[model samples]
Target chain A: MAVAADGRAAVAQTAVAAESRAVSSNEIIAEFVDVHRHYKMGDNVVRALNGVSMKVSKGDYLTIMGRSGSGKSTMLNLLGCLDRPTRGEYRVGGRDVSKLDDDALSNVRGHEIGFIFQSFNLIPQLTVLENLEVPLFYQGRVGAESREKAEYLADRVGLGQRLAHKPLELSGGQQQRVAIARALMNDPLFLLADEATGNLDSNTEAEILDLFDDLRPDGVTIVMVTHNPTVAQRADRTLWLKDGEVEKLVTNADRADAAPTEESL
Target chain B: MIRDTWRIVRLGLKSLMLHKLRSALTTAGILFGVASVIAMLAVGEGAKQDALERFQDMGVTNLIARSKKPAETATSNSQSLWSALSYGLLYAEADLIQASLPTSVVARVREAKRPMIRGEHFHTSIIVGTEPSFLELTNMQVREGRWLGDIDDRRLANVCVLGATLTRLLFPLENPMDQTVLIGDDDRYRVVGVLSEQGRTAGAGSTPYDECMFIPLHTHQRRFGDVNTTRSGGSFSRERVELAEVKVKMPSSEDVAAGAQVIRDLLAQRIEETGDVLVTVPLELLKQEEESKRMFNIVLAVIASISLLVGGIGIMNVMLATVTERTREIGIRRALGAKKKHVVQQFLVEAGVLSALGGVVGVTLGVGLPFLITTWFAQKTIILPQHVMLAFSISAAVGVVFGLYPAWRAANMDPVEALRHE
Candidate 1:
């Protein structure tokens, strides 16, 4: 299955090589050129993504929306550098990461991208302060400066007073806030959130969405993958995927006019 | 880098702390292994030292020639008559040995079981008749007064040197030196000196010297005849041995083997058919004992290491389970920018810590067991510092060796799939 995916990604990579030459490195935080991902299940090849091309500019608040098996997860994995695209060129902070090895990808993931999970994946064993220092710890940069930065990020996420608490000790909203604080601790180039508010109640979800909105104006590029249309409506633009292909790319004005409602379901 | 390692170690410790009972049980395996290694080595060392000391007491440079009645010849019916058997080391043999090995100190000994009396007190002990050279050859020390001198031997004086135990039994409360002790039924001898305690045993085939009294060779020959007769089961057996033993000391340790061979050849030439004389070299016995000790230690080490092997397997089993249980944690670490090396380091350090802990506890137990054995069992146990370190190091290495597979499994987990795991 991985081999098939790699073949598809390789094909997509050459298709975008010429276009990538025209794109300026300084203005773009992330770019996916003709990206493809496929999985082989028994006798069938399940295409997760096909020739998906996009660019994430600085300060962009982008949302990827899709139903189950709509390539949203695969796109998140590729964008987060957790896994390489099978055949596409993925440039993060203007560096081609699609062909990089696991270690180099890990370096990019550590310094260039921050991940926020719906489950708030804060290490239960560590306190809030330690969780915020993990990225720096990986970079071998843990010291007084990292501690001060953690403190500041915790305060920015409204978790300044809960710095010593374990993740399980906090409410869902508070844990998500801690996760957000951790994501910002490394001064990453962009934030990749997977179902960022999916585990929270509506009110807590709204609070987290508001936190994301606040971070956007401050030039913190966020690329969120979620299925909820209501969540997608709040982004500057939403990329809709269906059957491993781009169904639509809905901008802010287009979303305001459409305003997905109960009738649409 | 040091700080990072410290953090990883702390993290490893925290994970191990989660399963306190399991971790401790695993540690116990190594603990017992290390303890057994130390205990066995200690026992071996103590036994070796004891044997060495006993051999040393007999004097490593000294060679002993003793008279033994040939088993085949003892069955002869003529042996029942007094003065019928005339076998064993002769006076001429001693003289020949001394003449041939001029650089060696030769002491001729004649032993007789005689009843000793001091006033009203009476005790039976072996009376050893030896020259002054016997003192140096046998490494015997004088505690008080003086040993039997050349004047005593030349004049046939009735002066004796009492063994430590004999002095205690004969004197009880009075000073033994210058005191008179009666031997057999009528002969009286003056105690000129006392020998320091030489313990109960020496090397192989040597008599326990602490319970015997020493007198001049000439005096012993004049007082007691060369023939000794004993009646057993209504039958009287008689044997005539001019010299019971001949102790020959070489000038240096290196000359001992050659000197012993020369003495053996001379004795063989005289009584080649009887085979009634036995030559014992403490140095030879010491070497044999050392060889056997090495074999014993190797067997002991093998047994102890098997326990350590079991302990290492226990660590591996627990670590593999830990890796499985912490799959999600590993994924999280990888997402946070932990390289595969970091993941490997974490688990390896965890295993290292577990074994090191076991090593430490085992050392404590190992060191303590010898002391307990020495105190309660009354067995000598010497714990060498090097052995303790060796056992501890082996345990730690076992941990690393056993931990590698599980650590590799953890490090090789696909981050995406791992994160998806429940």
Candidate 2:
């Protein structure tokens, strides 16, 4: 199955049919095949993820939805190169991410993915513009260029007027905007948001969700984790995670026409 | 890395500024430790230097022979008495040594009492009768007129030299040069010169050189009988007047030991008698002073080092707290491609800056403390040597050694976990 006309290249010896596939190509951006993740609590070991496998294609927006402790966050961490799977191969853009050292993993994270946390993990001491400059500093840009890029990003995020304000001084919605701007500074290939709007009210969450919706037209790939169906409904596709494995995936079409409510599902 | 260091330094200083009271208290520890080191070492070094200066003033290589007696019968009280009775150097003994040894100058003193007067002022003084060479041998200087001549000693002229202070006291307004001052009952001696005043010896109580009067030895023997007494086979007999104080001068002070040895050998051959003489060497005292100076420096260094240790410990404690406080910051830098060495260097710079600042403070306090102490207590001013600076530099090095571990700990923190921390 050639996923031609797509930006990614995928090579698999065996392929399984995924239901309601809307992607025109079989291009693979990430592959977590037969991955297992475990944790130890005192004497007994508990499995956080059990034999879970998934793939994402180029320019694909994904949503991994689950309740607390369903391994959604753990999967996100693995996808972001923050943690390693206990078993099986994990690949990001066809590179074996599982084999990288701590330094290399950090480099991979810095270069390959941009992370947005729920609490807007902007360094509180820095201003909105400085927060955007942080990743640029890590990327080894000089002061003037980094500043110019940060200012441009701040303007793009609609935070030009509030660049001098600290994260603590900003509203929750504004703070998240700063985080998103910071994430985009290095022009990372993948954007991973873990409950990015969890701390915000519905109005702020809706605003941030609209911002995520706005990013799609630019062809930047995104993956977000959310428990709320309303929030997940904004994504092009949603993967329902149960007990650390992918239970089902739903397309926006299935969600729009006669979507299953909580009781019906 | 340089930019990172600058950023860290700016951050550190800002943090310090945020906690003003805490920073002050920590800096105070460094200040006191440095100040105490400078002050203590300065005092000790000053005392050692004072001793050496005094020793050098006394002449490093001169040999002095004070009268001494046989050890067996000499109790502490009786030693002086026995030594006085021994009264070692006879005039002939000095002449014999002078002829036998290749020494520079031999000064012979024959003691006699003479009552001298100028107008109505009469005072009994120890009239030291000696040769013309005595002036050089004793290291005495003439303040006015001239020293007694060879002709005066040979002809036994009735003339005397007054010490500077005595001359001042006797002749208040009028000049004493070429004036007659009576010696004994009928003889009137001309005061040809005044000797320069030498300060009082700590060993010789209240006996300053200014109180003495000098006359020809042959003239002294003609007037007063003799002061030398000797014993042979338990029988007391009058001996030709002995040399009261025999001062032997060499070409250099370093030759004093060899000169003493030669003098002893020459005396042994001429005397033909045992247990009759004693030799006391001031050069031995000089050696003892040198040894004491070494011991003094060691003690000073030990005391100074204690304060330096305290300073180093203070730096370590500050660095440890800094490491703990900046754990997350360390994680961020490490994640941003900082090597372990880079992280270590950031913290080491902080500590190095601290100790280097402390060193500057130490040097300032070390320099100022001496003058301050002198003025406050009205004591002698202290002199600090170049080696004190060397010790302070070592203290800064100690700061670096002690501070390294905490910096390493901060540098080695796990980035992922640190980022996860609230």
TM-score of chain B of each: 0.95, 0.80
User: What TM-score against the true chain A does chain A of each candidate get?
Assistant: 0.85, 0.84
On a 0 to 1 DockQ scale, where is model 2?
0.16
TM-score of each: 0.92, 0.74
Q: State the lDDT of candidate 2 residue by residue for A1-265, as single tens digits.
A: 1222121111011011221222454457678888888888999987888888877776677789988889887787788777788887788767888878766876777666777888777766666776677665655664755666666657657787888897889999999998887777666656888888999999999998888778765556788888887887777678878898878877766535756433212
Candidate 1 lDDT: 0.86
Model 1 Cα shift for residue B69 (angstroms):
2.4
Q: Residue A85 in model 1: shift from native, Å?
A: 2.0
Which runs of model 1 end up more than 4 angstroms from their true locations? A1-26, A42-44, A254-265, B72-75, B203-207, B269-273
TM-score of chain B of 1: 0.95
Each model's Cα RMSD? 7.4, 8.8
**Cα lDDT, model 2, residue B46:** 68
lDDT of 1 at B34: 88
Report DockQ per prediction, comma-separated: 0.60, 0.16
| Candidate 2 per-residue C-alpha lDDT over B1-422 given as tens digits, one digit per residue, 9 for 90 to 100 | 67855766665555455456765666555555666666766666666666666554445554444333333443424544334334456667767667755656776766655567899877766677778977766567898899888888889898889877778777888889999888757788899899877663421113445777788878777766554555578855443335556666677877877887877776663334444565655566657866886787677667677767777788788889877777765655554344566668777767766676667676777678878887897656465666556656775686678779877887677666655655
